[model samples]
Target: MDSAVDGLVSQAARGLHLRVAQLISEVEQRLRCEVPALWEYPDARTSEYIAEHIGTILNGLEDGTRLGAIDPPAPEPGRTGQLAQYGIPVGAVLRAFRLGQGVILDRMLEEIPRRTNDPELVGAAARKLIEGANAYVDRISERGVVAFQEERDRRMQRRLSMVQEAGVRIGTTLDITRTAQELADLAAEYFADIVTVDLLDSELRRDGAPAEDPLLLRRVARRSVSEEPSASVAPQQLHTYPKGARPYRALITGQPSLHLLDMPDEPVRGSIPESEAGALRVHSMLVVPLSARGATLGVAQFFRCGASLQFNDDDLLLAQEIAARAAVAVDNARRYTHARATALALQRSLLPRRVPPQSAVDVACRYLPAGARSGVGGDWYDVIPLSGARVALVVGDVVGHGIRAAATMGRLRTAVRTLADIDLPPDELLTRLDDVVLRLSAEASIDTDGEAVEDAGTEGDIGATCLYAVYDPISHRCTLARAGHVLPSVVTRDGTVDLLDLPAGPPLGLGGLPFEAAEVELPEGSLLALYTDGLLEARDHDIDAGVARLRDALARPAASLDATCETVLDAMLPERPDDDVALLLARTRALGARQVATWDLNAEPAAVAGARSNVSEQLSIWGLEEFGFTAELVVSELVTNAIRYGRPPIRLRLIHDRTLMCEVSDASSTTPHQRRARVFEEGGRGLLLVAQLTRHWGTRHARRGKTVWAELGESVAFPQLALALPGWDSG
Candidate 1:
């Protein structure tokens, strides 16, 4: 069939064969310069391979073989493989082949007029070349499609793996900004040239209200794979965008957006200013909502510019998947932040805002709760102004942390204050506080059947430790006691720091243990440091090392009490203490001898008149004539009671400080009782008479016997002394 035509084709093919190298070179040069898609493979080796393939097609045509009989070149190895390696799509690779085919036919057709004068021969050669080249390009392009699809699938799998990895990395911390930054970084690394994450202001606030439309979005994290700066300003500093902006719209609609980021006619607007867009060289963008649990937390934006491909539906899907996971993480972080803030507030309220002004001691205190990870704990300190210008310095730590422990600490502090008001000794005060804790723990325990029970070792157990010290300015002495507490540190006037060798009683909740009081004569200007275990033990250091460090800090040259407290804390505590810390620093002071006056009385009623006259004269000499009468009457009654009820060695003393004090000491251990005597009774009213003339009166026992003391506020300024003469006999 058409044998003579085939021979004519063969003759023309032989002539074209001589110029095959010329045609191949022309096609290769055209592909290199004209086809932008093939520019990725600019290497000379790739160009040579493409050119040789064109030569194969021309050789098949010259052999006079029928189009079907001329087998298509067994898929040229790695010709399109280069395109797959560079992530060039199958369409781009095929377009390059089409361009090469055009170049070959055009160059050959131009040669037709020179090869033969006949128009018929010229048209016949053009037909043979076109048919062969078309078949050759189709086969090569088909193979390129399979390779490109495989490359796309592999890339998709890789991206999926990246998304899964990101899910693990993001929200690893319960911090909102950090989680958002993780999402942005991962997106820029795997998906886009530029990525920015914006969360709703309400979500960040965790205000528990529905997020409003055109939600106020805050850009928390942004990243750019390109070397260029993302914008003139950082994304975090950009803050909020207008209502109709692209990111806002995503939040309002809870739908993702795919469009040109900087397009003039694009529905997305106002998020990025035109100036910022130009700086970023933004061409295409995908804005996806970060939504989870039926609420939209934020929006994530990805930008592709320059040679990067435009955003497609597939890219939008991937961004949405990643955003979905990140949104949940962000929401969780927000909730935790809110809860932590609440706990922090509760803790602050439970702790003392300011220590009470202590007259006997210049006091400064610090209370620091654990960081967010460990939560607020039960550290507490108080400066209580006890009666008679004495102060009780107390520090306590409830075991465990959080709201319950803080509440327990508050209750214990209250108990200590109540016991202190009764003038109980330090050891006795702590002993009562322990009983209070044990009783509270028992009350907190309720069985499953709704019956009250004791859970001494379980959740109801309130494990706590405390240090209590009563500092008496009058005596210049501090009585220290501990309930499983760290011993107090004493910094002497000479700048020598030493931990008190006080006995460590069992912790407060452990009842029945005797708490021993350690009495020390604290010199005026000496420092007393009382603290909870947190000040002597933390995650980074043991109790012993912390105490040593604290000692060193205290041993420094004398500074102000406040400064000394600050130095000790800075030296012993870490940046973020894992345990709650509390410290109380006090400098002791005492009344000078000029501020005090004393008188010794006989163990007889005859001594009372002289004792009263002596105290009255002392008050007059001290410029406290205003307190003369109250002082004389207090001295008379106290001296009378000491002589009548007490054994021997009766003594009366007067001290003028912020208040006027009258103390009567006797060898007898009997404490005088104040009584409201009946009209018929002239006796049993001596102590009562003293109480009426003073602010307060109380009895404190000593080793020898006891001291009954009465105090009058100097400002009371009672009338002048009047000697009460009773039943005088006439001579």
Candidate 2:
């Protein structure tokens, strides 16, 4: 559009090309050392740059310097002139390069036709320059960090591998002090300073309630071992930081930590620097958090100083890495220790939480753990209140009593509670428990043998001996099942101690063995003793002798259960348990001023009338006039079930105070199940009627027979039925 401008641009283009070749040579010559990597892109923008910046640059120079040799259109004279856009030259651009400046060159670049150029090609050149520069800087900084970490991790693993070797010995150990010392020595040597390791769980320290601070892990670790802690830190400080302090939060939280402190002369707040008076020389401290399943144990620290040698970044990184690995090791150890503790706690929970005081019927329970420190045995006892104002006293031993045994005891104890809650008879309760144990065993999940043996026994794998009995207040009858266990002593009020003659039954976990219960009259105030084989299996005595020893121990003229149980247990078991011992005792309560009678059953409808008459006579003898109100309904259901599905020979008993118990035995061992119904069903409603009419009902294992029992509550009748059944449904 402008001819003068066009000619000048043409001339300028001719001149600028000459100038750029010169400028490139000059840049390469002078700055080759500084930026040898910088390169130019071969784009159309390079042509425009040569025509513009190169021409102006040469014209700006005086006579014949390298750039001045080129022909360039002169800018308008005597005016502060900006070069015309198309005729910029090279000397100017060269000067800009010498100043390490790109602005002038950048402005000149913008005037070029960039849209038609490959932007990516240009950007690629730029990024290479940036990355090369950044790379140089990072090598000086983070490279050392990487090296430090690798070295530290290697050293840590090497040291801890030794500790793990020590751990092999440690697991079977009763003394942890030597193991603790060995670990501490490793830490101290690697850190090149004083390293102190404390037992996080010391048996000696009885801290109130359990410590809330997860960082306070000594309880889980050492409390089970020592009576008092030998090493400890100041309780973790809560006020170390205020709310809203960050990265600072990491300081308070249970994390492995290292601290740099400004210590001065004279100890101040337990953190005085080594230069202080009478202070042990400690300059820098490194702490590593030790935890498992997110529970933090005590912090272990390494303290060193730069008084003689400086601590470098290498040392810091190495220290941090080693501490990290150690934290993991500590976590694993804590898990093993806590698992032991948890197992012990469960074992204790099975016993009385606190000692029971003197009571009428004697009760004594002593739980002797087999091995204490490295491993613990599980054995426990309970004297529980039963339905119908009786007492259910039980003693049991999970076989091979260690962690697995302890855990099994917990499960079996829970099973007992569940069966009792449903109000099962003693023999059938054992059956249900046996089923559960067998199922657990078959699943092959029970890890007995301290998990030392991979193929440790099952619920069926490890059998247990348990004796369960219910002593009734009205009849003073002790009904019991001894499942392949020691015979408990029965001491009558006349000072006669007799070993209960037990009919053989398989141990608890052996499925489908016939177990018969032996019922005996307590003769008013007889004391019964139950115990695990740990007592009988002691080194000094054969089992028969242990039983004889128990017989005499029961005749010790003991007044309370605690003494009786202790006397029998201590007499039978050794001071150091060869195995675990579980003991339980109970004294009988004489007939509660009322008459009790039991009526046997037959399949004939005549049996129903006989049952009703039997209930009437016993209730009248007990002076319970209201027994007629509820006794008829309970007897009717049991008799009716016997008449229909039950194959003959049922027994009904009316005890004192109108406690009507009706038992119907059938050839079928298949226990009766209550079918939940829609209100119209008539036939399956007998159990429903019995359940509503009675306080509770249960079943007992008889030889080739099962006794389904129903009891009358409060001598009263239920107002109505969900479904009324035919009268002939009664036996």
Please report, in order, the local distance difference test score of every candidate based on alpha carbons: 0.75, 0.54
After superposition, candidate 1 runs with Cα above 4 Å error: 1-149, 172-174, 206-214, 225-240, 262-273, 291-295, 443-458, 538-541, 598-615, 629-653, 661-731
Highest lDDT scorer: 1
Clash tally for model 2 = 35
Best by TM-score: 1
- Writing each residue's lDDT as its tens digit, candidate 1 over 364-396 gives 888787765777788888888766567888888
Clashing pairs in 1: none
For each candidate in turn, the TM-score is 0.72, 0.51
Question: Candidate 2 at 12: error in angstroms?
Answer: 80
**Candidate 1: worst 10 consecutive residues by lDDT?**
721-730
Write candidate 2's Cα lDDT for 1-731 as tens digits: 23332233334334444456655544344434443322221111333432443445434422222222332323211000111111123233333244322322332233222322545534543343234223422332233344334545564575566555544533343333444444445555545354544334422133335643332233122111112323233222222223322222333475544454455222122222223312444445554444335554444445554442223334445545554445445555445556667777777866567533322255656777765442556466766654445667778777764567788787887788777666567788888888987887765543454343355543347577678887777666778887777788777778888888877778887888867887887766677777777777766778888777777787887657777777777677666667767776676655454445666677788777777777777667667768675777677777777677767556565555335555666776667788765645556766776787777887655557776777666646444553344343333
